[model samples]
Target: MAKLTLPPLPYGYAALEPWIDEPTMRVHHDKHHQAYLDNLLKAITGTEFENVPPEKLLAGLGQIPEKIRAAVRNHGGGYVNHNLFWETMAPQAGGAPAGELAKAVGKEFGSFDAFKEKFAAAAAGQFGSGWAWLVVTRAGALAVYSLPNQDNPVTGGDTAILGLDVWEHAYYLKYQNRRAEYIGNWWNVVNWTKVGELYGRARK
Candidate 1:
């Protein structure tokens, strides 16, 4: 019901250095993600949806009013997904999953390398603006999924534990036309601790 507000970046804009540049990070967070939050707030104002929290709206999208559904779907999803995406990385994060997440990755995809390969392929293969996700299906299995333009695994009955923004704004400033390179580089900054936490909570 209240206005959707932009969440702060977990680390400084420049923290994702070498992979994602500071200017890009600043624009991506301050401009792109904030636009989504502002638009979502505008889209739902004075409607029945106005009172719903951004996360709750995302989690129960089917209940959103038909009148503003598309706007909310796009903007709200951008807000929610990007928030998760930011938190899913840390300046000092990345490398490999530890604890149960490492074991699960091995079990699900044979090894972390294989998991990286699959996630990268999925992210690269997305035809346009969208996201690549590591999700837990309702059937209680872990899998990779790609959703077009702000659409997310939540819509398909999966719990997203990890995600990568494949939108041009997410990479163009740094990687130019080399999205694959961006995807490859992103693996180096993944916040496995946050991911592990999401996976642990979702699995339970």
Candidate 2:
């Protein structure tokens, strides 16, 4: 099987400006995310995992060969998660959920502000490198979850509808030590259209 390749950014590196700078997006996507794609491919070379799609590899980490499991879990998760992360925002996105997502948010948390508070708290409270997620439970309920380094809600059977990369590298460039500010600004770029689409699919 061929090795996985890094996907191009959906928009220009500078597209996310102000909220996310050009140089940061460039390095994060080109260098860091690409390294994960390369390392994951290298780790799976000549192994059964070589045939697995990068996204599927992340969804089934425990089933990978033990010799390369850790590499796949780390690098593969990074690759998949970052892929989703990049598409989860845009320079023109964010503000508030819309359509069914807005209604769901209203029903789930009473209002959008409440949801934001919970999500921000979850992101800020993560003790170390990890991600914060808005996921749909198997029972069709929405919930907030935080996972440590490369961990995702998929590992626990929850379907991630949207997520935020809370790793220091994700925010250090712009927010410095103020992680809350980073989380707050992140709300300004969320691609609610994509998130609502994912939520619909997950609910089905």
Candidate 2, residues 1-204, lDDT tens digits: the string is 555788899999988888988878988898889898888888987776688786676677678778888888888888888988988898889889898889999999999999999999999999999999999998999998789888767767788888899998888888888999888888889999999999899889
Lowest lDDT sum, 10 consecutive residues, model 2, at 52-61
Clashing pairs in 2: none
Give the Cα error of residue 96 in candidate 2, in Å: 1.1
RMSD of 1: 1.4
Model 1 over residues 1-204: C-alpha lDDT tens digits?
335578799788899999889999999999999999889888988777787776677778888878778888899899889989999999877899899888989999999999999999999999999999999889867899789999878877898999999999999988899999999899889999999999899989
* Candidate 2: residue 117 lDDT (0-100): 91
lDDT, candidates in the order shown: 0.88, 0.86
Model 1 scores a TM of 0.95
For model 1, the run of ten residues with the poorest summed lDDT: 1-10
RMSD of 2: 1.4
